[model samples]
Target chain A: AQSVTQLDSHVSVSEGTPVLLRCNYSSSYSPSLFWYVQHPNKGLQLLLKYTSAATLVKGINGFEAEFKKSETSFHLTKPSAHMSDAAEYFCVVSDRFSGYSTLTFGKGTMLLVSP
Target chain B: EPEVTQTPSHQVTQMGQEVILRCVPISNHLYFYWYRQILGQKVEFLVSFYNNEISEKSEIFDDQFSVERPDGSNFTLKIRSTKLEDSAMYFCASSGDYEQYFGPGTRLTVT
Candidate 1:
């Protein structure tokens, strides 16, 4: 079994300020962690993923996340938040072995960016 | 970049009516999946399909729900009798080994 938990349900940040969304996961297998962002009425876009190669993974839109094995955490961070970054973010986990990996998702963190 | 595509972006149906949600996954991907998000809720996996059959399914994918890869390009989910509780945003996805690409979802409203 694999599960994920997003620490914050809502995160408010000023544009150009820093952003952080925390996630922790538990799995029976070596899991792959991912951050996905969904804009209003839009589909989920993969922000980044960690498959055990690099501890720190960079993604589009200046977003990045560091997978901390010691902490069982994969926290998303952006040095500067953009207005367009305001969206609902989901932390997802899956088994590393299969393309048929069943994704377990956390209740999302809604990011509100203000100017 | 290739992306998954879903049809009828939104659908409104009466309770007990049947509805079909359509998708065209990224070509050459061997795995397909369906997930749904209710309002203010977490995204939940429904089912995963591979090799023209169901590989795995969550409990939420009950008897009323079925999946089909009837042709080469189209994958579909059919609800034999939709209930008011079935209202959600249904997303279709296709994946290779490392990543899954999702479609823009079909908003299903059963009134």
Candidate 2:
């Protein structure tokens, strides 16, 4: 079984400030992790993914995340926040050993970026 | 860029009526999935399909729900008898591996 936990339900930051959204996962086998963002009235969009290649993964819109096996974390970070960044973010996990078919999603974190 | 497409962006049906949602995944993708998000709630998986059969399904996908690849291109989800609680935003996704592409979504309202 694989599961993802998004530590915070909501995160608020001012424009130009650093942003962080924490996520932790548990899986029986090798895991594949992903970050998805959803804007108002829009479908979910992939931000970045960790397929056990590199620990640090860079994504679109100046966002990135680092996968830490020891800590069971895959925290998303951004150098600076933008008003357009306000949206819902989800952390997803899948079992690679199981052929990476099904995915389990976190409850999600609602980001509020203020200018 | 190739992307998933879903029909009936919004549908309104009476309680007990049946509804069918359609999706056309990326041309070459082999795996397809259906997920739903109730108003103000997290998205939940409903079912996944591949190779002309269902691969996995959640508890929410009971007898009332069914999926079919009826043709070479279109994938459809049929709800036998929808209730008020059935209202939600349905999203269709297709993936070959680690990353999946999603459709705009179908907003169903069971009144």
Backbone clashes, each candidate = 0, 0
Measured with C-alpha atoms, the lDDT of residue B61 in candidate 2 is 98
Instruction: Tell me the deviation in Å of residue B94 in model 1.
Output: 0.2
Deviating ranges (above 4 Å) for candidate 2? A97-100
Across A55-100, the per-residue lDDT of candidate 1 in tens digits comes to 9999999999999988999999999999999999999999865676
- Model 1 chain A poorest ten-residue lDDT run: A95-104
| Complex DockQ per candidate | 0.79, 0.52
Candidate 2, B106: how far from true, in Å? 1.2
Highest DockQ against the true fold, candidate: 1
Query: For candidate 2, lDDT tens digit of each residue in A1-115?
Result: 8888899999999999999999999999889899999897778899999988889999999999999999999999999999999999999987863332777889899999888
Q: Provide interface RMSD per model, one decimal.
A: 1.1, 2.3
Q: What DockQ results for candidate 2? A: 0.52
